[model samples]
Target: MFAPRVALASLSGESDAEWAKACARPAGAAFLGGVAVDGPTREAARELVDRDREEFLPEDPVAFVDDQLAALDDEFLRAGVNVRATGLEPLREAAAVCAAHDAILEVNAHCRQDEMCAVGAGESLLRDADRLCEQVAAAADEGAPVSVKVRAEVDGVHLPTLAKAVERAGADAVHVDAMDSRRVVRDVAEATDLFVVANNGVRGREDVFEYLAYGADAVSVGRPSRDPGRVRPVYAAVKEWFL
Candidate 1:
């Protein structure tokens, strides 16, 4: 599990290694740099990412992932370094890079972008539980710690069941974008043994404590952590809670 119990969720714009490093604090872990893979399944992801998101495409995704992990060499030595990535083709490859670099590799299943779903990446996996489980299993098999980031409410998808699936598939942790539902985090926590990292709408110390009270092992900060001043209070609260 991550130290201090505070995590920087894989916010689209903030996920680059450089940006994540800049945002890192002594008490929290920064989930750095998300990458898209090569293949037709990535076209829609590319289109969607091109609009407002900062997505990275390296000719070799494994190298790109390795480079990103390597970029955080100094930070890795001092704090936890985790990477969140999408795309079906490179879970194992990315996991390998993470293993090589001693970083955590998180599979992104929380993105609900229309374009991402159109390409069968992102939250589309929520609708395809079997495939997602397989991907996570493969990544975990690569000898790297794997965390699956999943959305709570997605119409027909059952959050607790998916959490169980991820745990059964060997994922070390489950990162939940709880959205407006703290109950989903509770349910997932109850259903699985995996460490639960609660994400979404975590604005202040209250939100952090609220999620932890609901059974989250850790809490992730998204939009609010974008401001340096905002990070201190949240970090202090998390540190205090852990203490």
Candidate 2:
């Protein structure tokens, strides 16, 4: 789980420097991944990992995951790191790596990429509640403290029900990309005791306070997270609230 205040939402497979930079800032925790996972060595996370070996996505996802995790310095380790993975098989490997590193393993049910969806991964898992819970359970079974990241307002997806199911599966937390519906955060909070993290377009201190008021244990900053300045006020606000 994250510290008090805001968290950094997954920003794709960018760079360890970028990740370290974020964690070095004021955010409570940083979520890494949306990492692709099809088979053990078969790379299928086409979005971040194309045929070319770009900045972050390499040929082997398992190795790539290790490299990304290894990039986290002592400061990041203490701040908190949650890794998001797409497929179940890949999640298994990710869970093992997270367990070893004392990090949180998050199952990504928030991605909407067509290729990942075609494989029953990403946001596609939201529609398949059983599959999503199964993946979450599998990650937990690996002895990894698991969290499920989900997007609310998606067609046909019942946020509350899905949250309860994730709780039943033994996930340690649920990160909700609540989008425009901040109320979903309260609903999910009421549904389960699992730590609830609210994510989306959190602009300033007001939005952060609003989500917290809605029962989010913590709020996550997405696009604006690249700049630490944006979250400083939010983190300050949270700390002040606790005082």
Candidate 3:
């Protein structure tokens, strides 16, 4: 049901439009700009920058998303914006821009930074299913495709249950960071019909096949995405698996 079998995952500050454009060839899709929207998120992002952790703290989150997605080549079947916001207004506004550009507005519920959690964003949303689903619903209400970026091994989190909740909240997909627990990708795929994008340590066809064999509809690469040469093998793996 999806066009892209492989995607490039978003990297803080680094996964901007230029980065996406540079790495556009190997992958079928890309997630760009984890933009920090709203006062609390932007402030927290600035704090992260102080610690040498780069973040996209744009003055206008909505426009930033627009310009970034607009810069991507149409060779990508899907383009997405990974956004961080503690409020519905900025989130909705950013989603509208995604809708306008036919890009997916991805809710960033996966970031586990202490600063992000302190502001009730990132993995904090994962812990609070109600809040996370609410953000999904809000973004979906904007008439744009919605995906929730999430991670594994969080305290008290069950991937199957969480995936079901996200599906019910009007999400089209779940971008899962299978951190150390790759089998959670299987659990989540079996639990919900949401398009599952398995991420983390996807170095070769072996890793891609592992996720695919576990029932993932797609796979993504994060840090490795910076090198198109590194991404080429993963792209070949996806094409082979899908065939």
Candidate 4:
């Protein structure tokens, strides 16, 4: 059986202390720096295209980049924070930040917001698999374990292709945004030798177990982290089932 591990969702805008509290969760194994390359909210994101029309290019193409990098740096400076991993764009600065922090770096290719695509980040990489592979390889060459996070397509044809490409790119793992049912996710996992982590819609112990059984090496929980009181029980349950 795969051991259950926790990943905290969306911490890019949060302060270091806030990130530390989430990382301190006993079951937590990784932290996704929530740098929404797109707008922070749905309504804001919808305005991205219209907003872009007013400028020659997207306004503040990387508006969120600096803040996200700062948050990652802050997390790194905290003592005994145990933040072994983080996710970011595979840019030179992002690679540098991950190296300085001694954290495994994951490329964010799962974001589906229009703003992200408009700015040529996130799922936009899916359209250019070779470049994405090159970027991941570059990060790996820099002594950081490069993982790529990708959303599973609705039709499922692209998932296998993306998984295989990441594996060939020398990535340490592939984080699958498994918003679909557990059964569908399991089918995708069966096709890859690379380490797989399931994210999206994982609410509690049973969901975690279902993911593990489906071949996820780890599972990430989102909303549960907002309430600190819920972390222990979830951690305890994971320990009970698969530790």
Rate residue 2 of model 3 by lDDT: 43
Candidate 4 per-residue lDDT, tens place, 86-197, comes to 1234254445555555555677676565665555556777777776787687677766666777777644337777778878887777777777655656765787787777
lDDT of 3 by residue, 147-243 (tens): 9999999989987899999899999999999999999999999999999999999999999999999999999989999888998899899989888
Candidate 1 wrong stretches, greater than 4 Å: 49-52, 76-89
Assess every candidate by TM-score: 0.90, 0.88, 0.97, 0.72
RMSD of 2: 2.9
Candidate 1, residues 1-243: lDDT per residue as tens digits?
Answer: 767677876666456677666656633566764456546435654675668666665567677667777777777322222333344446777787788877777877777777766667778888888878888887888888888888876899999998888888889888888878887898988998989989888767888888888899988877765665676677777777777
Residue 44 C-alpha lDDT in model 1:
56
Which candidate comes out best when scored by lDDT? 3
User: Lowest-lDDT window of 10 residues in candidate 2?
Assistant: 76-85
In angstroms, how far off is 103's CA in candidate 2? 0.4
Note the Cα lDDT for every prediction shown: 0.73, 0.72, 0.88, 0.56
Clashing pairs in 3: none
Alpha-carbon runs more than 4 Å astray in model 3? 73-77
Predicted structure 3, TM vs. truth? 0.97
Residue 40's lDDT within candidate 4 is: 36
How should the candidates be ordered by TM-score, best one leading? 3, 1, 2, 4
